[model samples]
Target: MERFVLTDAQWARIEPHCLGKASDPGRSGRDNRLFLEAVLWIVRTGSPWRDLPSMFGNWSTAYRRFNDWRRADVFKRIFDAVSDEPDMEYAMVDATIVKVHRHGQGAKGGLKARP
Candidate 1:
């Protein structure tokens, strides 16, 4: 019901590739969608795993999944897939006016200014 919550249809499509086949027999709910959903929630919100909703699963489970995915380069794989799509392209360079930080303004009042 949350704004960023992934829909069942979306999960069905991504599950095959991301999670692969189901777990072995007698596997508890521990090896199911709850952990997967928790990981997705943490990533979508850009929040700490400890803050994951109880409905999704334990925070520890989510954190493990995130670290596992990172170590396995799963996120990079997903990005690569999306980037290969025909609709993705282009670059835009922008020069925006903004005040420079004091450290970035190098010797403006010194010999540098005279040149």
Candidate 2:
């Protein structure tokens, strides 16, 4: 499977928020960027952890790392860091569009008579 790529600028922005940096205590992560990409792949494709590609290493390890980061709120930190300056110039919402399910149309009898 094709993997995602982060430009130098993009990496620079998120690097500080990532876990297992050289400055972090304990054993450093093997490759934080690759690990993140693995997580992204699972999220984007909505695939189970068992389906993770071999290129990203063991699926169990990736899932464990994802859980560790999630429990630490690392993902929120990264989103906050990168979304500091969002471009809302073209943001929009279509309130006119609505979906009505078949069952929601109502039963044939508007009201049933009392027995």
Candidate 3:
């Protein structure tokens, strides 16, 4: 009954790449889709791990699992699978989300210092 971020189809595509499947030999994840949703929740909200809601279970547990997956490169494979073809039809950079380097910002006499 949790609000989920991934559509059924998107979860379908990413599910196979997830670890701890029933078919795997080790301990199975309580719920792969749920775990994914929890991770996505962190990403979308930019919230600290300690602030992760109770619906997603323990924050520390999720953090540990996330790091485990990261070390195993599981996310990379999932990203590769799902992003096989990126849609560049409307790619644009927005200043609000973009960061300027200190040097680019005249920190140490940038353009103004130039001849």
Candidate 4:
């Protein structure tokens, strides 16, 4: 399975926003990072939870942990934290690379075109 690479800097920003961390960044932080990586792998591959690799631990357990995090809005807090700092690797995109189809650009379509 492909891995989700979070840099140490990125992880530092994200770690504080995550739930269930001990006062020390010990076992719990490592477990939380692994759990997060599992979720990210599922998302990156667009794979069903059942197909998660054993390296990430059990698929069902990861899914349940994902739900727990979601219910607590942990993801939102992480997004809010990370979004404030624009990391260059993912920060910029060229609008020229995006293509629009004619229909999407307000061309007449469907029944109107058929008539």
| Clashes by residue pair, model 3 | none
Which candidate would rank higher by lDDT, 3 or 4? 3
lDDT of 3 by residue, 5-115 (tens): 888888889999999998988877898888888888899999999999898899999999999899999999999988988898779899976987776776556366658
Query: Model-by-model lDDT, in order?
Result: 0.61, 0.86, 0.88, 0.80
Which should have the higher TM-score, number 1 or number 2? Answer: 2
Residue-level lDDT tens digits of model 2 in 34-103: 9988888888999999999899999999898898999999999999988899899767766555656657
Cα RMSD (Å) per model? 4.9, 3.6, 3.8, 4.7
- Please give each candidate's TM-score: 0.56, 0.79, 0.79, 0.72
Collision pairs in model 1: none
* Candidate rank order under TM-score: 3, 2, 4, 1
TM-score of 4: 0.72
Candidate 3, which ten residues in sequence have the lowest lDDT sum?
Answer: 105-114
Q: Assess candidate 4 and give its lDDT.
A: 0.80
In model 4, residue pairs whose N, Cα or C atoms come closer than 3 Å (at least 3 residues apart or on different chains), thus clashing, are none
| Residue-wise C-alpha lDDT for candidate 1, range 1-115, written one tens digit per residue | 3543556755554554454345524323444355566666666899887788877767886677667667868667656644554553465445555657767987555455555
Per residue, candidate 4 scores C-alpha lDDT tens digits across 19-81 of 778874433434888888888888899999999989988888788878978998999999899
| Candidate 2 runs further than 4 Å off | 1-3, 96-115
